[model samples]
Target: MREFVFALEYEPGCNRVADALADHPDARIRSLSLHATDDRLWRVDHATGTSAALEDIEGAFLNGDYYADCLATDDCGATQTTRVLDRTDDTLVLYSTWERTPTCASVPHIARDHLGDGVLFETRHEGRHYTWRIVHSGVGDPAAFFDALEAAVGDCARMEMLRAATTEADAPTGDGTGGASGLAPEQEAALRAAVEHGYYESPREVDVGDLADHLDVPRSTLTYRLRRAEERLAKGYVADERFADAPSTPL
Candidate 1:
């Protein structure tokens, strides 16, 4: 297996969404970062670090978190969110959510889908939404990976609205959405900025170019790095689960 990472940036006034995300299923509170905004939510994931045997992949789709939060303002303010899952060694679904709408005109290569061993991430802040997905399959052919990731992000971003992929019958609440340990300074900096900038509003306007500029890297590069941060979060959850099952230390 190879390694890949994905990350996302939210707008200024969409803090509420983040609050809801903290409680999302498939979220793995042990694997996410929580921003202090009522309207925003941010996340990162490393999509390539898993060692699943290629033969283990089955033709199936899994649902992650399902979250909802009230929008004080806006006509279609009320919303629920979730993520999609696939375990194909040939392909992986990095990120999926109903947090908020995307703002980019054209999806960046990093956010596409169908690439092998890639990562995907999404975030909402200040009403502006951001998504990133990457692929680093051992095949070393990121062209198709990039194209697919970009298309996925683009398709997801342009969505008029996002719906929860699950129903209460399946999940009463949902997955946990928290922070992972290995978040880079840059990724954390972006999260901090989203908080400091007041970009966590539901309908807040955000500039992807501006955020890229702030991080001092191309949007694609930043997206990859952010995904790495998310991997750490996801790994943290796995570690915690294992630790939970392990024998406890003597008092």
Candidate 2:
């Protein structure tokens, strides 16, 4: 199967649920179960935040014309039926089945429209950014899907295509034979956090100290993990045939 990964940045005012979440930067929603058909979208989400955030989120889900992952909605649009599976002061579990309307456009619908069936979706909603990991049996052109999604989203949201690749379904995820990023789990975690937080960006969005605090790890530990991860990546890169074929000279 192939995987098409992308992200959407929901600027406030474009989406009610995302707007309600704008104030709670630390709040996050994780997908538990999700499926979509031509007529309905069913989802179960795990949300964590303060009471205020949860309350606003709940209202947005069941009240006025709110729908997650939808770019637009209009009057007389079909509303969603939502239930609170569980709620706590800082966490909420929600189950919703939404009726699809022609006035609205969502990621899953667009994907099905373009990419066809036999696709699975996983999502992560953090702050203003939502990342979607879609797996399909190579149904449609990922490039076309990206363009369609961007055009459909228009000015309501920003789209970034992270990955568009085809992989064997039975391929080993990682053989642990020290090939292609054979990092220890801790090292990989630290490196991923660093990259996600822009540690490697030019002019550096974050330093090791800042990233350590972000991950709740000690400064020294983070530094070591990053250093080791970088070493492995650099060595692997230089060892590849493409690099070996390039002209190089010792300084």
Per-candidate TM equals 0.25, 0.67
Tell me how far the alpha carbon of residue 16 in candidate 1 is from the true structure, in angstroms, after superposition: 42
Q: Highest TM-score, which number? A: 2
Cα error, candidate 1, residue 232 (Å): 1.0
**Model 1, CA-based lDDT:** 0.35
Candidate 2 local lDDT, residue 243? 77
Off by over 4 Å in 1: 1-181, 198-207, 245-251
> Any residue pairs clashing in model 2, and if so which?
none
What is the C-alpha lDDT profile of model 2 across 20-111, one tens digit per residue? 76777678788998899987899999889999999987887777566666666444376678899999999999999888777777888888
lDDT at residue 146 of model 1 (Cα atoms): 46
Tens-digit lDDT track of model 1 for 225-251 = 444446656787998899999998899
lDDT of each: 0.35, 0.76
